[model samples]
Target: MSRPVSTYRVQLTPDFGFAEVAKIAPYLRDLGVSHVYLSPVLQAVPGSLHGYDVVDHSRIRQEFGGAQGFREMAGVLAAHDLAVVVDIVPNHMNTANAQFLSVLEEGAASPYADWFDIEWREGKVIVHRFADDLPQSEHYTVVDWREGPGYRRFFDVSSLIGLRVEDPAVFFATHEVIFWLLDEGLVEGLRIDHPDGLADPRRYLDMLRDRSGGVWTVVEKILIGDERLPDDWACDGTTGYDVLNRVNGLFVDPEGRQPLVALFTAMTGQDADYHAVMARSKRDVIDLFFRSEVERLARVAGASVQDLVDLLVEMPVYRAYVTPGEPVDPVARRIVESAAPNPEIARAVLYGSPEAVVRFQQTCGPVMAKGVEDTALYRWYPLACLNEVGGEPDRFGLSVEDFHDFCAGMRPFTMTTLSTHDTKRSEDVRARLQVLSELPGEWAEAVRGWSRQVSFDPHLDYLAWQTLMAAWPISAERFTDYLLKAAREAKTATSWIAQDHAYEEGLRAFAAKAVELPIGDFTALVDRHAVANSLGQKLVQLMMPGVPDVYQGNERTDFSLVDPDNRRPVSFPCAPNSAWDEAKLQVTTQALRLRRRLGPDAPYEPMAAEGEAAEHAIAFGRGRAVAVATRLPVRLAARGGWGATSLTLPHGSWRDLLTGGLYSGRTPLAHLLSRHPVALLERHDL
Candidate 1:
């Protein structure tokens, strides 16, 4: 397997693409990255910033400079010895894609009808934007759009159509461009997007492996609490949410669990159960976002499919893999089998058939994506930092032993990252929020005071306060947009399709008041804590057992919120704050260089610290390289700043890579870390 020691994630769009990336290849190489991991480069919606919503899979997106631009970029990367890995959106295609348009224009007679996962039982393809088909006369007909048109789509996106990739012809047709790119050596590996949305993720991966000649690959799989990736999948591993959640778990102060919960309960004035909230959210998604799916499935079942809807709504994981030839997993089988249990013959009408089972399996993805990711995550208000993809915010923290075990097991195949385009908050934002645990009393006091100034849904209010506090130097417009998206996703007071004007007005008012709030002290607090966390987490991820991929601007103090905001341009112009980012970049470059030199397959061992600040430090060693990062800077200060804390290291003179200081076996961690929040040490003679 060809694995990159360090990968840099680039969000390719009309604004930044092949030309710009090629220009930066030397800079990235100098920054010590072994590869460039990129967003989808295929033709997509004209101005799509993040290119997951692809329209044409057969050609390179012209907005990003087309095939020639891609070749030029690849040449530059090869010149710098950097590998290329790109994201592929195979689960769905742009609704306006040629294949989908052909199906709409020609109906069942089109050669491309089978390419899409369309219901067709509705008799005609539902056209939303167009009036009719071309007057030149075609094989079939396109009709006017009707209310609640029946078709399959990507989540709630009306224009993104899901593909029937399970079909061999459809798979080959959709992946033709990707294969050509791989064969031509312009791209080396693939990052399969949203495999959970496919009928058989394992089968799709197997197909990808065979077609790509078994190049390195990882799925964009979100493994919720203890949900291990199936060992049978023919890919390297997941896109690393499994370990991303684990690494994020380390910063959480276990003691802050109740305080944050209690604060949330007090602010919201509702003792909302998480499971109950999730159930309601999922049901909302089923009834509103995916109503057409349920209605279509009902047509297939030849009756009301409320029973199947319930079965799908209650599914614990994403879509179950129900393949044609592969052996059915007993656990997956039980989930479906239990949902449609009927030994009696009359009951066979509902779900005894395989077709009903297939529809149910397909419905699970849209439901889970809308429910957990869109709704529940926004409604969840404990500590927003813990509310990351594949991370359970309810689960407070993981022990050092469990963290080490997780890394050791999933090291080689997994791609670990602290921040991504989809994360709820940036790494610095999360780091500061984790500070709330150490200062629970202060946090509650601050939040209560902020409430008096501005008020909204308790859950939304709490999330907003923490987000603003993390990045208080934010613009008012940015704050309003962030809060509005949060409210719509939560569906507490308003939504995307519908809005409660009165409730929305209150949300907007709160955003305005928040901008006027006196947040200088809070901003200082966030900056100080974020510095410690930014260094600590970065060092750990670089040294941990995996191919670490750094999101574009996150090598510095990236206090960005979620998507669009996180995906903004990466710039480092000469400014007052340039020193701070430059320092972080220095640390990152040093760490990546060390990783390149030492290699990744190293023995793992956890280090113990002895001192008053023992609880505030985490230490681990990978071969001769040892990384120590400070955990709770707020708590450390409160308790007189790492009083007598010391970490025992491997004997012999060790040089600090970050700072040029030297140390031996028993070194005082506090004195050593006083200069910087993290230390990367290697033996004097490696």
Candidate 2:
């Protein structure tokens, strides 16, 4: 039997920090939660909501009630028999911390000189890149070495300094904090952050797990397709972006590609393939930001301008993967061709010429190839690059057969997710894109009507559609304000680097249009498509041979965009009229109960069935218990699409555990389920 996930993702805060653990402990126990997964509770920026931005590694954040509170929280968890999994950022620390800031103040002379990925050559700290995406004023130089704390770089305007985790001292300093938490019995498991950015990912993870003393460990790794995590590392599984892509891909209609391609072609008039367009766009982003990075590297190396370019252009994907070692693979060249079909597009956007192309490929090939080469990489290691380049999207030329094969391999560690702190859009937003799967006539008519009324740039409109395609269930009221926040977060990129205004306008227009629909209509739309998508995800994720994950606030209803929006603190509705809360509680309770009843002896395998209607659903069976799920479309089905079809139950009379109703005829499972999610039928005898 698999170790089921009865998980709860909590954001530690002063309001509920260690103080509220006693109250929630009983609540989690009652809800049957086996583990409490928490955001980083270590010392962080003064009011840092998410703990990923660490400042002081030695102590717990005092804002969240500090060490005493952490101890109390641990005690409460132990009392409830729940495990505590802490999120740790092994990759970098916040520049705001005394240690990190002091490094900047003292320059190369600082005791912590080797504590970061800094290059000091010309009597000053060096910055690798400038904000090409941001407006360039003397005040806003490309590299801001004298910023808030250590040195400043992009990742939103936040003063987050990327550490040279490859450095031994840096690794040990970061580990010291984690070890403190572990040795104190404050944490039972760890979720490593951004494994992709690390130069030697395996070394860090191995060191962490060994010192963990047999604690459960999972990396926040992002493997795109066919990429497997290094098996030798001590890890339970990834925080599942690979499984997310595969599960999401299964829902996309392969037949819908033609119309999408045509629509995009008409909008852009660019002859490039979808993959080429995406590649060009990504190249544009990197190149737009490259000047400053090159300048900083030059300053650090004390080299001439051309020498800096030469090194960057020739630097291996990792310091370890340089030409002095292994043979490059043939498949890497094929992957490059697959991404950039037009050399002109590549030249115009990414690389300036054939030489630049070779250099860029040299860097990317080894980075991607290392995973295929079976290096000590975590699972989802390739996703760092893949996710940025639109990992396995239908638009990026991935086929259903290819996608399904990928899914088949992930059965053991499949982690299905929609929105995480990392994604550009939430699942709800992406569901809106599934509207592309509808009848072309209807989809075209709706877009045309909206276009005529909105009066926005077509390019911006396309961006809006893309955003909605990635996330949905957006709150229209907060739309424009949020876009401004998002843009502001990305520094001067909006005004300077790309000169793009259509994105901001288009997002606003889309939000406005969503609000035009009545609340009833909106709810109905959400339930029909969003709910079905959620259920389908559960079927694909849970039934598959992996531990399914539910991001912080996803269980009840997820109407969030990327990052800070998705990372909003979940507030349980106050008493009496908390129907939404109650309903979520019921669904979670039933799912866990069903999992328990299946027990250690339950037999699990994919189910096979025939019929056009069955194609709309995915079926899974374990011995006598069979699960049939409805993969409904974006629009509501007329009469709810062939209500419950008959399943020849084995022997004894079977009861619908969800509805307390009897199953006798060929009634639709949807009908039997009513509003309840899955139908649970058991034999009358056993």
Candidate 3:
């Protein structure tokens, strides 16, 4: 039997649909991808690019080639020895059109009321008044009844209502679609999206897996820094960002830590305690975006509006581990107090005092990253800088042993992701961002000078770009619209957004000029800024091991900032075609080929060797295949690299595939690796 299909994403609704999929299947197959991952195929709000907003769970969307087309696509994939992995949104469904509107119109009396999670009292529909920033009272309406013909109440999103998966009836009703697909063998795996938003994640996962005959299941879970997924769930590893951070973080310059912190401080004066910084940022965001909902909630609670305020502000952040009905024990005030080294400081700036922290601990002891209030915040802060607080490459605020423990537990199932639907930027986009992090005082000066030359506000432009680029890290599809918004809101030419095409052109030129100098020269001028981005990308891809993932169209280059820009489709012209980009193809093909030749199941032992320029180069071996790469090309290996500059094979000769050089047991490795960015050698025992 063929191996399971894996490493894919969904593309929905085009004149193309499955037929279009057939066209790309060959390209994907060549990349060693097993499955053609798909977005939801269930009936959804018309013209939905991502099928998250399903309208009817039972039927295939008529616009996406429906059931017949879906079946045909599966057949084509099977013929190519590939499987289908369809994304399923069990948390909520879309209420965007007439069908859902009718459900709301019918109120609680509708027969399908129990099909949702309804909290109804009397005839009033109690929709959550989301935030204080929106003009809901004057612009939108709410009712007391929680259930309607097609609509139901979810946490805060009435437009995208929730389903009570905990309810057996609801589970059964929703599983109808799942059952049909699995029974027919239409899909072999399921990618559960937004699992953090669900009430009972483990239970839902177990049920879905068990019901599907142990079908391959991966979830859309976001695990920060050291958080691990529940081991109890029967599933394969996550969609793969957990590993992304480790690999990415390894190449970061430890020396740049203090400087980057200082730069942000100079730029954003509000930098205080990291947690406080995050809280203030989030508060501003909520105020700006959710104002109407907050105001409406205040109005509904009447005179006890203070209670409403307290709930939203004082409550611990809700996530996968804290949803209702899960085991929760309020932590004692004493326990919280004892856990903190500085109770007063924790009380002053953190989200909760010792008491509230204890309450959370009592509820979810041994929960993912809840042990450290700061750790949790750093992981969830969403800003890369804030998250980078104490994670230096050679040193860490958290103990390395503890970090390892966390990594071990997390390795089995945690979602290893670089980008998500909620992230500000994509992994590739962020990799480009690291170019700035590596720069010491020098790159900042260059940027300042460049800003002066361009006749633009450098700081403002950088800020705009940061804001704009932030969204690229997320997995959402509406990224381009976000980009356009960034452009419109840019305060300067240097800002992420610009006045026109000319501004974008100028900004690109600046970046191009930024990378023009030699790596050593650049690093000398600004503390390793030159090698930082490339180093960061390589480090993340190779070292911090997990199920490595490559975001769509990011294998070769990533210039996206925020949503609209990042969400642009992979056009044949601009997008890197593995068949065309020789450099990228060389890297990707070599990496994948090495992984295959080593045999995925082979045990790997870490080996260390001294290079002629050890500081500028690192060498390690996987089985008999030794790999070496130079970090800063100017720095040669220190110990003369065995003086021979060639590597010795165990018994037989080794071949350098890229350079077409052959070596025996007496050759010096350094000489062979001299002209290459990277070198790999494999010795077959046979």
Candidate 4:
């Protein structure tokens, strides 16, 4: 199995395809990444911006230069000594898929009938096309759009139908192209998308491992707090939301929990408890979007629909990892019993019904995604940065001891990332937002003033204020799009399904006014500290015990927000336009190059600081390389700035990779970080 020393994520779209990737091969090599990680490369829905909605499994996307172009691109990357890691979406595919279309056209008689997870009744399939005038098919019936589809869909998205990958025939058919690429050595590794949606994630992974010769792979599994990946799964590890949340938590100030919560609750008139908000959001989604999934689970479990809904809403983690026909893992059993509405249901799920168990496990992921990440995160954000995917907003900060513990246990080959196309905000934006935790009073004042100038809906105004400050100097158009998306996702005044035009107009108008408001001074104030947090977190993430991934253009600074916003085209051969940009670029390049040199086998050793400000510093040694970063810069500055704080190096002359400064023995924190808030030091003797 091959593992990358580090990876650089590139979002491949029609505009930026294989040729574009080929053009960047030399640059990516120079950027010091062992692999170039790409988004989904298979054929997808037409004009798709992000290609997760794959339509064909047999061919490369023509819009992205097809098979020949991909071959050329791979060759170019190989010339540059850069391996490839392709993201494969095995959980679902676009409804436009030929196999799915065949099933629709021919129904039960189609050769691909078993390829999808469709419900059959009396040899006829029932589908909800969201239209009254359904297309006439002899073996299928179209019902109300709100009704459950005949087939399992991806997270309420009707267009992306689920794949029954647990079937041996379906698995082989869908993975043929991927296996061919793997055998040809065009792709060295794999990133499996949404393994939770599969009927049996562990079984699917075992098959994947056996077939692919156990090449390096990581699943895009979102692990909640203290939820470890199952030991049976045959992947390297998760795609690193666990690491992301921990690292992000290091910068948050725990002291800000109360004041921030108070301010948010007062302004929004909502409950201060994040879990309560989350539960309400879960129930709302169950009532609105996930009714189909709930109904199906209830039918399979032979339980009441309401009981299943209640249990799903109470589920703390994405899934319990329950495997049928085997003794339930104690941890998984505990999770289900705790979340189940009653003991009988828990027994039914854990011991009795295999169909019920599988359906329940599969449904948990979509419900959590829609309810928590999409809805609750948008609704009850005391500190917007903590509302990230797999993040708990109420859990404010992580102690240095805890973060070190997490890193100590991390699988070294698992990918760690800061920003991605799916991130709610860029790393830099979150860095900016983290500043609020240290200065809640000022942030509240700023929001109050902004609200007086232009207020939209109370439910969304606080988020808008935070967005404006974090993504400062944002264009009105971009901000409006984000705000609109936030509102709809929140499902408060307006939503994607039931658009309230009048409220939407108010939102747009408020966004326009918010952009024009005098918020630059406050943003500048936060940015002064944000620069420190940004550099510190970037350095820590890069040097941590995992394959760090630098999302495109994030090596410098990017304040993009959410999907289409985060997925904008990135320009290469770019130069730093600001001092902050220069510092971040230097930090990114130096750390990446150092990690590349150290390789993946370096051991991590935590280094403690000595003095009154010791808690503000996070230092770690990875063999000959050492990383030191400042956490909670606002509070650090307030406490008289690293006075008397010092770190004992490993008895060798060291050179600061960022500043090229020399150090030896015990180094004072003030002198070590005089030039920049973060330092990447390599032993000079080495």
Candidate 5:
């Protein structure tokens, strides 16, 4: 099980199962990925679109072709020189899981009682159910849906119950099938989903590594600004939200902040301060959705519930990485010391009850997910491109030097991705939106025109305008669904638990009218620049320091918005439908193939550009391979279009893999990028 040079992520559903993946083996190989990264393949709740709601781990999903189908798919991939990397969910499982049902029926007397993270009180387990009248069970006590189940869960999803993988028996039992897959050489790598939710991620990973012979592993860990993965964690590196944010930031303009904020404030009549909006959203979610979780923590820690709530709302990162019995990591200690409203509570979390510390750490991740990524990101999105899972909307851009520093320190085998099953928008859609940061005034005027034609809630209208523009040509139905979801997630005009029917109806009508409005002209205005950004970002992502992953269908221009939309069935064996699509496909293919040749240990050096337009070019080298892409295309065009910019090659003749143009010595940027906005060059001594 060697590390993958790169992976192509496919969202496998009931319709597109292991057999369908096998059909794409030749295409994935031809497209140049070393492996096909499949979403959760374990049996999930029947017909689950995204397989995160796994129901059983002991069997391969029947809908996904079961054991036999998986074997057939693996054989085809192996024949094509491709491998497999599976997304595994160890944190939680669907409540309808057999073991969980047994727990419900037999409680403490059940053979599988220790498998779940349920808290027992007087031999009765409390469970949350959505019923007008609570049903009584001798071994279970049913509570209101709003109450936190007397058990740990994944985020606020009650239907997904947490697993007690900290127990050795539970870990081995749940991972039996996965271990079998590894032994049979059916899977080569593992992508651990939501490691932050684990009671002891470090210990869980240690056990996994010890048992599985340490095949290449990465965690779905979201690192905040300047937050580094703990060196002690037994994994390769993060799934690459850190790299995604930095790469996304390279194309954003810091200068656009003030004007964009002003325009957003005027249009939406909402607070322009991102931090304030996020803080308020955090507080609201705790009260509205996490009251039960807070109550449970308070009862366990003997700390005031309000203090715990305040601390959770203020905590900066997802988890503190407090390992209960072990000494708190310096980083975790510092974060808790800084964020805690009371020093006593901080001490409790740091050196208090093991159960208390673990619960607090688990609670922080859900709060951040529900608060910032889901709520505030939707509420105050002046620039929607910055609203990714681990991105900071207020932080506008990254300096070239800073970006290089970030890349230089990356773990070689760590996964670096621009898009995934979880991204709010696809890479191309964000590329289009990034153009708006450069042309805020034009965007503002277009929004004004659209607003004049059709209007909804101002809070939602601002986000709707951005979404509509980024994913233009989207159907009225698709656009309507996206807006409704955004509005509910924002929890401003409407919410999932509490619906505003009248406002939702208006939003539906608005979507239909807004899509029909004269919006294509505006999209056309930014189309060329957007194309440049798209190619520029794609080339950089594919050639950067880590193992880059191409989300399904993103090798071409994919203008999808959020999930269900982003997860739509991709037509395989795809051909270029347009010039932009062809250009993007060429870039993706050339870069991935070059990376495969370079291997994982190639040295990276920042290649500096000289002359007037030097700032506009981002050039880097990996062994004999070089990647040069234009940044801030609109600004570059405004500043006279790469007049005298030149990059000195590594003292040899070089051929552009993209266009086959030859170059040596001081190559002029204007000539190198004359054909496309990006160039992938290979040094050729001949």
Candidate 6:
């Protein structure tokens, strides 16, 4: 089975539709990507930039040029020898979808009633509304959407109703269109979206594999804390957060965790563990944002919803797959038994009915997404790189040995990425922040200076300062928008449902004041460090033992924050304006071409850097290729710039693929890395 040399991820909205993508094929081909990994391309809600809010499964998004356009784009890619791997959202669909509308209009009598995961006994498909204005319709009765199970939703997003993919009927219904595309050779592989939300992910993957004649597939799965993908799932691997987290961990200073944590603790006065904070956040979600889900779980367990919430708060991980008639999954049983058990809920969590298992399993994703990723990540400012979806912010950093262990463990053909549409910050933004871990003294001094100028909640102050620095060249408008969103997501002072006007206003005022401070103080410091880390990390990702993906526009510095912020249009005809950007593009293009030349199934080994400043670089070998990236440049430069350091290259007159220079035997690391801060060297043996 062949894997992609590199994948370019494009978000297909009305602005950049298939026609526009088709125009970029030659550029992608020249840049050396083997496939175009697209965001959800199905029909979505009107004018949705991010297509996760898919409304129709059977049709290509007409808003993004429809099926004809997709066919044209696919033809163009095929002509270039590029494959297509589409993101499929089988976990949920928009509430306004035709099938969902049918369920509302005809209630239980509708043929599509079983298509959704609705609690039929409730007799109401309650949709959560944030705005006061409600559209009165005869289709579905309007009720205050609170926590309880009338209809399953994706996280707290009421508009995205969950699908019952465990049902053979729903599975075939949702996937028929996708398979037809595969048959037509428009799509070569499938990347399943939110497979964790399914009742039985393994079974669904098996079915997809069988249906697609064993075509390549990857899931958008997050593996937390030493968790590996289950051996039984018949797919390639994840869409890359696992590799993202590990590879990114290499650049961070393992020494920064303590000081950052100390600062975070004193500022917030919250010394409780991260898991405890997560537990509290989960309970807060149940009471405030997700009352409907809690009520439904309560109904299934025959207990007060509070009891169910208490039980759920202690869950060790996301819900385990508990198909009825099969023995209870050990992971689920452990979570249930480990918690302070209420007999009624305990029974439901253990040897429960299909409904009970489902209700419990469904609640896990929302709580984890909202309570953990959205909430805790914002508040925990210990090494910002670790605060991402698959990262462990609480942990200091990953050691090279630990990374080697991971490389040895996971499947080699798995996809690896640094940035995606869902990333909280672009990889470059986080890479810049990683420099702060090494500059604790300077950072602390700057933080104290800003503290005198801007009055914010101490907790908010720490977060605000970091957020500003991470995305330094942000526009005033986008900066203000990001600050407000950050404050709410942190839930330290204000929340989405209820804004603390005084608190929010103060934070905004602080943002305005901070924005006036010249970015020069940090600009130079970040520039040197960012360049080293960016090139190093990018080289590591591409040459490492996995299918690396380049999130569109990441070939240059993308200092974007989350969501609408990260979704801005990338100006193409990718002209490298600055020397740094040119270096980034050159490194990216060279590594990608090298990956393509190296073929799919190459092996990996870590190489040692000897002599002074050795600690400030990471070097690895993949087949006939050797990738060397500089780290902690500020520290390395301060320590006399690789004074005596030399990276022992694998023997064979090695040619620099990027600059066409040659190196052999113990080459001085400084001489090799001075020009570009990173190098992709190919042995002439190839």
For residues 1-686, could you state the per-residue lDDT of candidate 6 as single tens digits? 34567789988888999989888889899898899988889889889988989888888899888999899999998898787888899889988778877776677788998888877655666555533554554445555654443677788777888898989899998887798888887887778888877877888998888888888888988878787787789998999998888878888887777777777786667753787777777777766777877777767666777677887777756665677778876765666777635666777766766767767777777787787788878776656667888777877667777877788786877899999888888988888888888887788778777777776677667777777887887666788888788778878789897799988777677778888887557866777788788888898888888788999899877789888888898877687878878888888888888888889767888888998688777788888988888877777877888888898887788999878899999999878976788889999865
Regions of candidate 4 where Cα sits further than 4 Å from its true position:
130-135
Worst 10 residues of 1 by lDDT: 341-350
Q: Which ten residues in a row have the lowest lDDT in candidate 5?
A: 128-137
lDDT string, candidate 5, 412-525, tens digits: 889999998888999998999999889988888888888988887888888898888889888999999999899899998799989999999999999988998877889899
Highest lDDT: give the candidate number: 5
Model 3, 251: alpha-carbon shift in Å? 1.9
Cα lDDT tens digits, model 2, 412-442, are 4323455566665555444444434544445
lDDT of 5: 0.91
lDDT-best of 1 and 4:
4
lDDT of 2 at 75: 85
List all candidate RMSDs to the true structure. 3.1, 7.9, 8.3, 1.3, 1.4, 2.4
Q: Report the CA-based lDDT of candidate 1 relative to the real structure.
A: 0.78
TM-score for candidate 3: 0.71
**Pairwise TM-score winner, candidates 4 and 6:** 4
* lDDT of candidates 1 onward, in order: 0.78, 0.52, 0.48, 0.90, 0.91, 0.80
- After superposition, the stretches of candidate 3 with alpha carbons farther than 4 Å from their true spots are 1-6, 13-16, 97-102, 126-157, 268-273, 285-423, 453-460, 465-546, 572-580, 593-600, 611-676
TM-score, cand. 6 vs. native: 0.94
Reference-based TM-score of each model: 0.93, 0.75, 0.71, 0.99, 0.98, 0.94
| Residue 28's lDDT in candidate 4 | 85
Please provide, for model 4 over 433-488, each residue's C-alpha lDDT reduced to its tens digit, 9 standing for 90 to 100. 99999999999888898888898788998999999889988999999999999999
